[model samples]
Every structure is written in structure tokens, then in C-alpha cells.
Target: MLLELRQLRIQPGQQLLLEDVSWQQFENILAELGEHRAARISYSHGFLEIMVPLPEHEKAKEIIGDLVKILLESRQIAFESLGSTTLKSDRMVQGVEADACFYIQNQAAVIGKNRLDLSIDPPPDLAIEIDLTSRTQLDNYQILGVPELWRYGKQGLKMNVLENGKYVESNFSPTFPGIPIIELINQYVQQSQVSGRTQAIQAFRNWLRDNI
Candidate 1:
């Protein structure tokens, strides 16, 4: 069945939606399509979404992930990068695969662990979502108890920090503390596209050294 799903798409980055799917069935599908990183699958309640992200979407994701890593490196912050890993919970019926996620504040808690059971282990301290086509359901992350979410869309990168079990828009990131993440990352991402990734990253590092 997973093999046949490939034939259903006529174009790249196309999206397919499935409704009224059982969690067991969703698990089966997820298992059948194990480790196929090109396709992103998301499940919430009884609905499942399979999407092939466009090159632009992937470009933004990569740059954002890279920028995040650089920031962590600059601050000497220990972090574990869980790149596009599926974070799910059976009990809450909430499942999501982020574009990029990291364990910064909770790094030590899950440093050497293999499998992450959200019921027992802590969730990613920060999750980044790139909204080129499909928008992430922020409410699902709220229920899953993700502390911070960085969503990049038309309005630029907006930080949504979890407060009182709900995400509220914030100007600063709790994880980075006083750093103007939105302005910095947005600048470097565009610079990378034009000046090349290496030069852009070098420029960012230089700027960071001078500023921080």
C-alpha cells in the first residue's frame, strides 16, 4: 500500500490527505513507510497528512536548522538535533513531525537515550516549523506540551512560547534569551541563497562574534 502511494502523486511537493483513519492504521502506514525522509507524514486525531515538501520548503528548513546549530555553537549550548523526527503520543492522539527540532534545555535528560517516549521523557525544548505550503496545527503541539515553537511564514519567523499550557506569541525565545532570533535567522537565510551557504554562515559567525 505504501508503494502504491508513490503513484498517487503527479507532481513534486504534492499533498495527500486521509481522513477517518484509525490510530492503529496510521501506525501501520507509518511503519510500512519506515524511514522515508522525503515524505513527511503527520497524524492528529483520526486524520493523516502525507506531504512532499518542495525544494524551497526544504531550502528554508535546512537554513533554519543550520542557523539554529550555529547559534547553539556560538553560545556553547549543548543540544541534540532531532532533524524532522516524528514526535508522537498514543494516549493524547497527537502526533507531529517537525521540520527541525532540538533538545537544548532538556538535552541532558535525553542525551544517551535511543527511543523517546513522550509519556516518560521530555519533549523537544524548541521546534521549528517552516510554513511554505501546509501549516502546522499549533494546538497539537500545545497539547503535546512542546515548550517553544518557531514558525516561519509570510510574516517572518514568529516565536510562540508555551505559557500556562498554551502557546503565546513572544518577542524573545526562552531558549536563547534576549537574542533577536527572528531578525538574525531571517537575514542569514536570505543571505545564504544569494552569497552561498558557506560565505553566509561565515558572515553570520563573524557578526555573532562581534555582537555576542
Candidate 2:
């Protein structure tokens, strides 16, 4: 019994989601990132959600590719976005996870801290959602004051940019120039786990040179 229990512990634990989860409990990230005690999240609304912290754009792609594979294997929903803001809709928002979020650099890219005190306005440039179990608001970018956000769901990928306070349909990103969003998604999905990330990024980059 003791040996069996120990072996079980070595295996990956099943993800636990709140039952009857609305869009309010998306705050699990605060707990995961060790910022729960410090954060002041007034609202969280989503049915399925996860917050991924990345060190760089390269890392972002890597994380995203891994996430895509995981979602497919688990039959979980997922989405990828360039960078936008997360909105705290007072309505039913819970159990949602924004996978591999993207944000444009204000000057030089600054490393995201566990807590981003945006003061008045400092939202990310892009945000992605998998939309596993619920329809978490499709217009989050507009609510959060961001100019653009990419959403991927059961219907595949779609881009929405907020222009003049209204969400507009867009393809190709200034944030990520000349990137065919769908192709990147496919590359990540088709390749091996280890090499998929690197290959996906290379495929998306306008020009890439191999060294060594």
C-alpha cells in the first residue's frame, strides 16, 4: 500500500476545477503563481482557464505549442491570441484559463512580474482562450481597453482587434507582422512535442537563419 501510494504521487495529478464554475474563479492563477495574497482581483469570469508565465517570445511559443498538444489529448478547449487585456466582467465569469497570453513591448519588452499594477491602464496587447466548457465573453479586449485580441475555439482561430472602442475583425498582426496565425497553430499541432515549439516559431518568423 505504501509503495502504491508513493507511485501514485509520482504521476501527474488531475486538474481540479470548481463545480458549477462561472467566470469568477479564474483566480487560480494567483494561487499558482504565489501572488494570491498580494493580488486584488475584483472579478474573474471563465469556465476553463490557466495562466502561463513566460520569459520571452520564444518561451511564449514553446508554452503555446505544449498547451495545444495537451488540450487536444485531453479533449480540452484552447485558444491562442497575440496580446490583449483580460476583463473582469461582473457577470458569470469563472473556470476560464487564458493560455499563453501575448503583449506588445512598450519600449523594450519588460519581463512580466507576478503582479502587474497597471495603475490606470497597462493591459497586454493580446490574449488567448481555449474556450473549453463555456463561452467566456468574446469581447474581452474592448472591456479591458486593449486594441487587439485573438480568439481560438471550436471553429478554429479568429482575430479581433478593438479599433475606436469597437472590436473589429482582423487577420495578420502588427504585433506579429506577417504571421499567418492559423499556420502557426497547425505547425505546433502537427510536430513532435520536443521539436514542435522550435519548428512552430521558425515557421512563423518572416526570416530565420540557422547557426550551428
Candidate 3:
């Protein structure tokens, strides 16, 4: 069953809803997906979300191709079959759907599967969070073994990438190299809705042609 909670506010009296989907079910689904970097899903404390890091960063632009699809694009949604992979296992870890996830290409990275065992080594290169309800950032990444984490908040986006066993300020993304996510955010902010990816891409092509 797909659980769509826009603003999942879990308090003392509201912990009953989560009991519906056990962690094992989540694990089974991921295991079924086989292998390829699928969206990572996990929920801990009171937060539940999905995380996805494309194996081919270029695939993002291709996936977001054209205007019709772009207009229909959601701020934080997934493709039809691309679904998600969660980190909910045993009684210790809960799962949360990562608003956005970014990971670099590596042998250890989970790729092309319905479900994945993120508990294993080489989690995500970076995971992005647009905090809608939960606030358990401190231990969440550690639990997922993600190298980088960015939590979007009222004060814009704050980034942190693991370095030398410690989380530090991060301005660069290990996944999509040479692309400033901050600029993308600014573009999104500047426009109420993003233009069709095709149109944007065409514009980019034209600009490139003019310059080069």
C-alpha cells in the first residue's frame, strides 16, 4: 500500500499510523527490485521518506525531458516504475522518504533494483532533504551511511558532506559534478514552475552554440 502523507505529524497520540507498514515489508520490496541505484527509503523517529541517486547523472536531464513532462513534474516526486528504496529494518531503524538523493557512480552503490540493502557498505554520495515535517537529521544520515546530507529549511538549504569521519559544510556535489545545486534552486525559486526540460535544454543548446 502506498502511504502518501503530505505533512506527517507524529506525536504521542499519533504513532499508530506507522505501525501499519512494518520494516520487513519495505526490505522485501527493495530486495525484489533487483539491482541498480533505486530511491532509498527510510523512516526514523517520526520521519519517513524516499531517497534516489541516479547511476547516470545525465539520466536526470533525459528523464526530465521536454515541456509537457516538465510541466507535470513534481517538486518531489518519482518516476512511474523508478519507485524508491527505503532503510527500515528490524526494530532499530525507521524509514523516511528522502525528498531528493544524489550519489556518485561506484561499485558499491546500489543500482537498478526495486529494493536495495542500504545497510551494506557504500550508501549514497549525497542525500537531499526538504524538511516538510520531520527533524531527525543528526542520526538519520549516520544510520543510512550516506556520505553527504542537505536539509532544506526556511533558511534555504544547508549542506553537509562527511569528511574524515565528520560532517562538514559542503558546497560541491559528488554526484553531478560541475553543477551547482544552489543555482538550480535559485532557478526554481525564480520561476513559479520550472519550464519544460526540453525547452530549457534547447535553450541551453542554443546558448552553447552561440558561445562556442
Model 1 residue 178 CA deviation in Å? 1.5
Off by over 4 Å in 1: 1-7, 132-136
At residue 73, what lDDT does model 1 achieve?
91
Candidate 1 Cα RMSD after full superposition onto the native fold (Å): 2.1
- lDDT (Cα, tens digit) per residue for candidate 2, span 1-212: 22321132111212223234443334444444443221112233333423222233234445454543343333332332322223343332312224445444432233544334333335555655443222334544455555656555445566787778888888775555654656556445344245755665454342223210
What ranking emerges by lDDT with the best candidate at the front? Answer: 1, 3, 2
Which candidate, 1 or 2, has the higher TM-score?
Answer: 1
Candidate 3, 151-202: lDDT as tens digits: 5544555668777767787777554345455554434432323664455555
Error of 3 at 190 (Å): 3.1
Clashes of 3: 30
Compose the digit string of candidate 1's lDDT tens values, residues 1-212.
35455456635668778889898988787777787558887778887888877787788899889989998998999999988888888888877788998998899998777667676778999998877355446866888899999988756788999999989999898988888888898898888879888988899999899998
Q: What is the model-wide C-alpha lDDT for candidate 2? A: 0.42
Best by TM-score: 1
